[model samples]
Target: MAKQKTAFVCTECGSDYRKWQGQCNDCGTWNTLSEVRLGSSGGSGAASARSSALSGRRGGFAGAVPESRLLDDIDCEDVARFTSGTGEFDRVLGGGLVPGSAILVGGSPGAGKSTLLLQTLCHLARTMPCLYVTGEESLQQVAMRARRLGLPTDQLRLMSETHLESMLAALDEHRPRVVVIDSIQVVHSDEIASAPGSVSQVRECAAALTRFAKQSGTVLLLVGHVTKDGSLAGPKVLEHMIDCSILLEGSDDSRFRTLRGQKNRFGAVNELGIFAMTDGGLREVRNPSAIFLDRSDEVAAGSAVMVVWEGTRPLLVEIQALVDESQLGNPRRVAVGLEQNRLAMLLAVLHRHGGLQVGDQDVFANVVGGVKVLETSADLALLMAIVSSFRDRVLPRDMVIFGEVGLSGEIRPVPSGQERLAEAAKHGFRRALVPKANAPKHAIPGMQVIPVGKLGEALDALEQ
Candidate 1:
């Protein structure tokens, strides 16, 4: 008999240590170390091998192994997809689910991860065999949700199981083409001694399921829980083990939800899928721009519209800013749906070069409709909105602006200039103040393009 060994693992960063420590050396978080016992792999090798072999009974590890072949020898023209009947969902999955692909969907609690997956399974069940296996929720509870959504329950099979071995047995028995695990954190393997949701248990169970999915040619959808910092919980290796990772984000009380593809092996990365939550379920928002933009004729001060590229689509979003005299010694700077640091930098540039003094004012800014403005293309619009608020002047109602501002006060060009202009034109925008480099070869019909070489030129256009 061999003496058992124990090691400490950081739940936050997944770094392991030889002994227990008060603070994690890797992530610098205090008291995140959890003890995990290491078991001998000698005697259990045969039993574990038997377990893996048995787990792959339904065409698991034995059948789906790929043979070594040259790139020229492979044929990929006939790759098939399992369409879930939802256009937005399929878009996020890179034009539908590929056979034997494992996808991990993660989000904050109440972000509607389970609801979206359930709705998808309902649609997939109509065409092919689909199973919704819930480790967190009961079968009856799932049935209630299906009834509430008015989804037909004839084709989809519901199972409530947490044990990994039993789940594999069910997979072998049913052989559904598409299967969804409500959450990966709850499912536990018998081989791991640590508790469920622990580092060792999560890693081993996710690996086992990923192997099973690859071997059986099943489209596996695993719901992952996010940490307090909005990242997927559990070991970082869990994210690397999947074929694709999708992040579902939005406010809890808001009706909007954005599905962003962070990592995709078979499809393009940074793809976006927008959905609107309703009583029936999640409905696809075909024209997301219309919802984000305020279409009223009234254009107020401190408001400007800019075209932003979310993946390949150009969306027009309204940027709002408010500047008020501060009574405190240090003026407050608050921004929602935009980075505060970026705002501070822009303010600095505005004062130094653009001749806008905002140091004495408590600055507040927000992107309308809860859409986060990550790209610097909105730089001109943000600064314009701030100036408009400070000067009590409203910008032209028919104009759209987008250009990246530099520290030296130059208006830099952004990518996809043609697409952004076309999007603005579609929305009846007649004038655009863009960077000189982004000027199109031919003028866009029904729109006047004003190319600005510097930040001051952009302000001159608004004043005129």
Candidate 2:
């Protein structure tokens, strides 16, 4: 008789445990452990059953192990790419979609993941056959959305099914160059007794589709749902199985949606794609910096412009701060688009080094345009903005600044100073305050570069 095995698995990290627990020790997620049963016969029986299940699958590649080829005999030329026709989309993929690639995209429910994929497939269908399989939405719902979005459905095929085998069969019949699984959570294989979104089922379905895409030279795109904590739903292994992982980050009320590349096998990671949600669908933001900066005729107090390097592009984002007298016993400190803990650290530095006391004031900071600044390069600008708010002074409208701030009140140079300065110059910024180490030998045309060694000197530059 085949042995019946039971184990507790974590839905967040796929860690296995002998017993149920309140929290997942590996991932630190509470109440995510689920009990699962596994059936396994003796070695021969288990191997035979697995072989039988995979043998007849449509996406399976034929032939046994082949003779290994010498490394020198392999071709190193660029792999052929199929453009989805969206410039920003293609750029995020590091040029265009490779023929045998599998991409996983995850986002909050209304972050526009489905709509963006639909638009991409609709555009790609104009040149090649595209298939969109929806396990959550019905055929009529997808069709209605296509009509509402004014997308052409001539070459695009929609299938409202959740069975993995049936989806594979359709892939064989249609032989589409591009296939989109509108979320992998709902797709399940009959062979797996677990639920659709369970760890086992999600892992199996993703592995099957990934193998199929690679063996058939098809561009496979899988849509995934994110948990409340902003991680992809299902096992974490699902992200590891795909060729690329892209995240759509934004809020319901925000006009701009940020598409960030988390992991990529064909392109650079951390590349950003900006989009604007409109009635007509998502429109790419060509000049992202302009939208992130204040458009008022005069520069406001407590607002400072900083050049931030996001992947290959340099974006000029405004850092705004407001310091007010605290009404409560303890002062309040708040930060948006910046780390709160880092904000507290910067406040301490302002008091200890710059001698600007804000212990009794409520300090609030925000980065304009819903953009989050993660790099330490914005440290100088953030501190300056806070100081400006404290003193009620306005920074020069035509100036930009960037550099890291040390704990001992020293301003340190950041990477890519030349690139950041060049971008500022292109935007007609006349002045720049950078670290002394980052100052260029030859000044940029139409721009003055003032290199500051200490934090106090930067504050003095604001006065000038």
Candidate 3:
């Protein structure tokens, strides 16, 4: 019998090394290498058989050889998609779930990853075959939750299993149109020598399942665990294997959850979905702007409203800034749901162009309702909010602002500027401060459009 070989692997980047080292040379991460046992040189019969099954080969070429064709000559028909029974969920998946595609959903515990899938599967099972396999929870527990939620449990098939071979066999037998693996971390392959959730085990199991999905034309939904730092647990290669990767984000205490797509082959990766946790289950937020713009009637000095384009629509969110005299030698610059470095750079621009200085003050900024503002369109709103707070002046509550401020004090226009302004106007915003290039040709019915080319001009308009 040939001796089994051992190799070191980096948990961060999934790079294999011959031996363990103090740091991973590939990812530049320290102390992330772990030892993994490789299959013997001779290879066990079971391992070979499993490998053949996964690859759909029987010791030789299994199908006819392929031929290359011109890119334009190839068929370019649109792929069919079926709704996931939830509009928000479907929106994040480009339009709907496509056949023969694998999607990985990841989130921290209690973030409603399982709840959302369960609800969607239950509704979808009525139209087509669906299977729900759980490796973490018992069948009784899942049934109890389904009963409590008043879901249509009769159509959805449930199975409790962890062995990869058995799960694959069940998939073959049931032949469901849609299959949900409660989680990939808990599923272990019989051929692997390592424990479940290990780097090797996760890689092999996911590869096998994805291959099956591709061949069988099944919509595969995988639930993935997240590390403490809020990234998907397991090898980074797992993300590369799937067609789409989405993250469900929210604190356990918060009722609102945000689903953001990190990667997608069929849809836009920048799409954002909003859901509210309730006794029934996760319900979609049709009008997210209203929920995110919920503010008190009394006007505040540091509060400002901004229109941000998210995915296919526009969102109205409130931006707040507080500037106070520094109590310590080094003034603290903190940002919640916003970038810290951006706040510093925006401050410098304000000082140079707008003639406002708060270098000695502690600056804190936040986006209301926990919505992360990634676009530079919020720059003008942030600057205006900071200025209002420093001067103890209250801006008009009906005013909306969205534009990008350059280092040279010029205001840059954002994409879909007219749509953003229209959305704000729909929400009853009377005044809009935007970039000159983004200004509409004709005036809106109830809104006043103020277009500014430089930072100094914006400050002048604010005074008026």
lDDT of model 2 at residue 297? 86
| Cα shift from native, residue 149, model 3 (Å) | 1.0
Model 2: per-residue lDDT, tens digit, 261-363?
8899999888888999998788898988878875678667899899998877788998899999999999998999999999999899888999899999999
Superior candidate under lDDT, 1 versus 3: 3
Top-scoring candidate (lDDT)? 3
In Å, residue 324's CA in model 3 sits off its true spot by 1.2
Residue 162, candidate 1: C-alpha displacement in angstroms: 0.7
Better of 1 and 2 by TM-score: 2
| Residue ranges of candidate 2 with Cα displaced over 4 Å | 5-7, 18-25, 36-39, 43-74
lDDT of 2 at 192: 76
Instruction: Encode model 1's per-residue lDDT on 283-363: one tens digit a residue.
Output: 999988889885577767999999998776788999899999999999999999899999999999999988888899999
> Which TM-score value belongs to model 2?
0.92
Over 91-201, each residue of candidate 3 has an lDDT whose tens digit, in order, gives 999999999999999999999999999999999999999999999999999999899888999999999999999999999999999999999999998788989999888
| TM-scores of the models, in the order given | 0.92, 0.92, 0.94
lDDT, candidates in the order shown = 0.88, 0.87, 0.92
Cα displacement (Å) at residue 19, model 3: 3.4
Clashing pairs in 2: none
